[model samples]
Target: MPGALTGIRVIDLTQMLAGPYCTMMLADHGAEVIKIEPVEGDPTRRFGPFPEDDTERHFGGYFQGTNRNKLSLTVDLKKPEGRDILIRLARDADVLVENFRAGVMDRLGVGYETLASENPRLVYAAIRGFGDPRTGESPYVDRPAFDVVAQAMGGAMGITGPDAATPMKVGPGIGDIFPATLAAFGILAAHRYAMVTGQGQFLDVAMYDGIVSLCERAVYQYSYTGRPPVPEGNQHPILCPFGMFPALDGRVTIACPRDSFWTELVTVMGRPELASDPRFRTNADRLQNSAQTVEIVESWTRQLTKAQIGQALGVRVPYGEVNTAADIFADPHLKAREMLVEVEHPGSARPVTIASTPIRMTATPGGVVQRAPLAGEHNDRILAGCGFSASNIAQLRESGVIS
Candidate 1:
């Protein structure tokens, strides 16, 4: 079956994580994403975790994981001819996405205004550290930033660690990934508007802004209490027993924000009377005596392994074991859901496993149907589609406009 964005053509002029990930989402759902790389290629193409014996090094794990289902075209946007090529490609493209620092594309002569002139219905999107001036001028507009900067500046790191004094960056690149996810949604929404009105607009997503949005709870907490929220370790600030607890083997999480669930948890813990105790009866009471509540929960949980605790809680309470990668790989639920998928490695005999798209559709299902492309792998094809002849492409390559 054809995918959801089967007919949509995307001109992807992005590198690294944020922009590539956003375009990857579109490509996974059947957009014809053309990734325009410089001669050196996206820096991630050299990123590691390659198979032990693989020597070709066409792409590494980071590139493969995010750049799948996209075509590769190398163009030197520094050159006027290369800029012309991009403009020509965008003339008919449904969308164009980039993640350069604000004003870089405009300096290269392919900014949204220039492209929108070529295609009135083109949805030109940018992912930046702060944001583009066209949307709203940011004080840090010209500053370069990455995931860690966004985390620190945007409140995620402020409320992430065990304590307020020791802020810690998140393990995953949520700063980039979350903004990418939002950008994908924004692009789709803008594209839908363009399809209806025949007018496309430029859209921007600031990495800092995205992280602030993700830390929304912190904002409301400060607003209500007039005190900036601090990291409260593993437990939630308001709910009792709503965090990680120790098990005989590992850690497990239990959440009981409701009285009924709290009652059910105590009953399972072999302490049904605690459900009626003044210190732990209602959610508010449990909140006031949270330390005692945690001690009681831990006393029961520490006596059981994660599996044992899971079996005891079963489906009555909200619970989950802290899952490591090994645990996830061995989980029957991941297998049942087809979340893990294997793709052919370019130079290795063993196929590499990567996560599959979670979006499922009955009529137009989308997924990883192709591997990440080799650098400039589809240059000829993409150029041809842009109305350049074989001789023209050869000349462009000879002139150092393309690799």
Candidate 2:
């Protein structure tokens, strides 16, 4: 079956995590993502978690995980011939995505303005730390940034950790991933506009802006309360009995924000009288005495295993145990949802498993059906499709324009 985006062609000129993740999601949904790489390949190809026996080091887990369901084409943009090839590809591309620093693409003469002139319907998108000055100017536009920088500057780290004194970065790269996810949506929106009007526009997503959006609750809380929200360990800022608690084996989380669910929990804990206690009767009262409420819950939970806690409260309220990777792999729910999927790894006898796309459709489900390609694996085929003769391709290769 054809994918929803089967007819779309994307020129993926991105590296590392942020840009590649966005393009990968598009590719997974059946876009023809042509990943244009530098001569040495993406820097992430050297990043590891490699299989012990695969000594050639063709690629690592980081590269494979993000670059799947795409075709690879190597070109050194410093060369005129290489720049020409990309311009030719852009002439017919539906979208072009890149995550270089502010002025890099313009320096290469393949920026949005240049491409949009050639292909009026191209959705040219750029992902940057502070965004391009063409769309909106910022004093920190030229400053280099990474996931940690975005997290810290955007207020996520401010309310993330055990307390205000200890600001912790999130384990996953939500800093980069969130911006990329937003960029994907922007690209699709721009594509729709281009399809309808035959006009293209420059779209930019700032990493700092993306992180700030994810920390939206803090914005509202500060607005409503005349004070900044502080970190409160595992608990919700206002909702009581809505955080992690200790079990005999491991930690579990329970959330009963409403009085009805709280009453149900008290009944389940064999302490029905406590639900009617004035100190914990209403949510506001419980919030004011949150520590006492947590203590009361822990006094009962500490004696039971995670399994026992689940047996008591699993289906009643929002409840779950703190699960590790192994626990997730062993979970029947994850298996039933098909969250983890196996794909063939290069130079490995056994297939490797990676997380699948969360998006599902009734008519055209999208997912990772192909493995990541080798560097420049589709060079000849792609160039030929772009009208390059065999001799022209060989000459470009000889002159170091492409790998």
Candidate 3:
């Protein structure tokens, strides 16, 4: 089936979370993504949550989660012949995405300037810890960074966690996701430009910059008051009874921004008199006594399940039941929206259940069509499409250029 990006070809030279994630989004929309790995393969291959325990063959859950609906290839870029072949592949590729240290591709003779010379319509993209070469390579560009480094330096760590005493990291790898999303946007922009002007351009996204963009609104109070924001745990600083409360089962986060919702909430708990009380009548007044207000709310909520609170508050006041992995896995809304899909791993008999795509199209909707590839599984298949013969591919394999 033809996808939205069906005619596009992306040469993905990224591993781990950020780069592969960007390419996956392109593939999800119908790009022909050919992931190029070193002879030993992407380091992610060695990462675990392996499908099967074996003396030899293994694949990890992280690898499977990000990489799907993409073909794979292996080429040792350190080798001159391998570099030659990569340049050839670049000619027909619509985009080239790399997350290596700034000079890695330039050193291998496959940098954007060289690649784009042959393919003027190519969108060359790079993801980096700080920024990339085309952005005037930073002095720290040589230092490679993963999600944790970006999160720590990019203002995310400063705002997370409770009380500002022990700052905590975000639960997911947003450091990678943010950069990938920005890169995807850049790619689309470049694609539009190429369609009009027949000129390709470099698109670069720094993980640290991406993280800062995501946390842009963190200083809502500080920007006006010159007072830095501090963590107030699950509580919103100015909103009364608008945070996490203990339920019979666990925590249920509730929010009642307006006095009307607070009145309804108080009524739900049979506390009409408390809603009428001058000390808790308005949001400002209630914020002054939030601790007492939450205790009052929890006094009733403690006897109920999160589901009970969610049911009582649904559409009446904004509330969400704090859910664990099990709760999310069993969520009816997620099932209805196709937010979970099952795919059989190449090395496993049983299927793996993973989060599904968030993209939805009225036409040309895509689903999980195949399992994530085994390491270098499509080396021949991808290279053969670029016009390599069987004997040449065999010789290249023999030269230890590919695994």
Candidate 4:
């Protein structure tokens, strides 16, 4: 079956996580994503968990995890002939994604304006730390940013840890991945508009701004209370008993933000009489005395295993254990949902299992149908399709323009 984006073509000039993640989504849904790497390849090819016996470092888990379902083409963008090849590809591409620092593409003479002239319906999307000047300017535009920088400046770190005195970065690279998700949607929206109106536009996603959008609750909460919200450990600032609590062997999260659920939870705790108690009668009262409420819950939970508590509580309230990676790997629910998939390892006899795309469609489900391409693996095929003769390709390779 054809994917939803089967007809779309993406010129991927991105490295590392953020940009590649966006293109990965597009490719998973059947877009022809041609990853244009530098002659040295994406830096992540060196980020490893390399096979123990492998002498040649073909690639690593970091690159393979995200770059799956795409074609690879190597070009020396510093060389005129190589840069010209990208321009030719852009002439027919539906989207071009790049994550270089500000003005790098323009300096190379392949900025959005240059490509939009070639294919007016092109969606030239750029992902940057601060965004492109064509959209808005930032004093920090020239400065580079990474996931940690985005998390710190974007308000996520301000309210994510044990307390106000300590802030923690999120485990996942959400600073990059979130912006990539937003960029994928933006690209699709722009592609739709171009198909209808025959006009292309420059779109940009700033990682800092993306994380700010992700932390929108903090923005409104600060405005409403005139006080910066502080981290409350594993507890929710507004909802009582809606965070992690210790079990006999581990921890579980039980949420009962409403009176009915709270009443049910207290009943399951074998303390039905406390339902109307003044300190725990309503959500607001419980929030005011959250510490006491946690004690009341933990006093019962600490005696029981997480499984025992879950089985007793049943489905009357939102409840879950604090699952580790191994727990997830063994979870029946994940298996039923087909969340884990096996892919062929690049240079190993043993296959590797990785997370599949979360999206599901009855007729056109999207997933990691292909493994990540070896560096410059599709050079001849991609270039020949772009009208390069065999001799031309050989000469380009000989001259160190293409690899």
Q: What tens-digit string does per-residue lDDT give for candidate 2 at 40-60? A: 787788898787777777788
Of the two candidates 3 and 4, the one with more favorable lDDT, higher being better, is: 4
Query: What is candidate 1's CA lDDT for residue 150?
Result: 95
Residues 1-403, candidate 3, lDDT per residue (tens digit)? 7778889899999999999999998888888889898888778877777655333444677888888888888889999989978888989988999998887888778888899888999999999997886776677777889999998877788777878786778989999998998998899899889989999999899998899888776656668778876667888877887888899988888888899999988887777888889999999999998888888988888999887888877787788878889999988999999888998766666788877678888787766666677778898887798899999899999999888
State how far residue 131 of model 4 sits from its true place (Å): 1.1
lDDT at residue 325 of model 1 (Cα atoms): 94
83-127 in candidate 1: lDDT tens per residue?
A: 999999999999999999998998888888899999999999999
290 in model 1: Cα distance from truth in Å?
A: 0.7
Taken over the whole model, the C-alpha lDDT of each candidate is 0.93, 0.91, 0.85, 0.92
Which ten contiguous residues of candidate 3 have the minimum total lDDT? 50-59
Clashing pairs in 4: none
TM-score, candidate 2, is 0.98
TM-scores of all models? 0.98, 0.98, 0.93, 0.98
Put down candidate 4 lDDT per residue, 12-99, tens digits, no spaces. Answer: 9999899999999999899999999988788899998877765667787888888999999999998999889999999999999999
TM-score of 1: 0.98
Best by lDDT: 1
After best superposition, candidate 2 residue 388: deviation in angstroms? 0.9
| Count of residue pairs whose backbone atoms collide, per candidate | 0, 0, 0, 0
Please state the error at residue 122 of candidate 1 in Å. 0.6
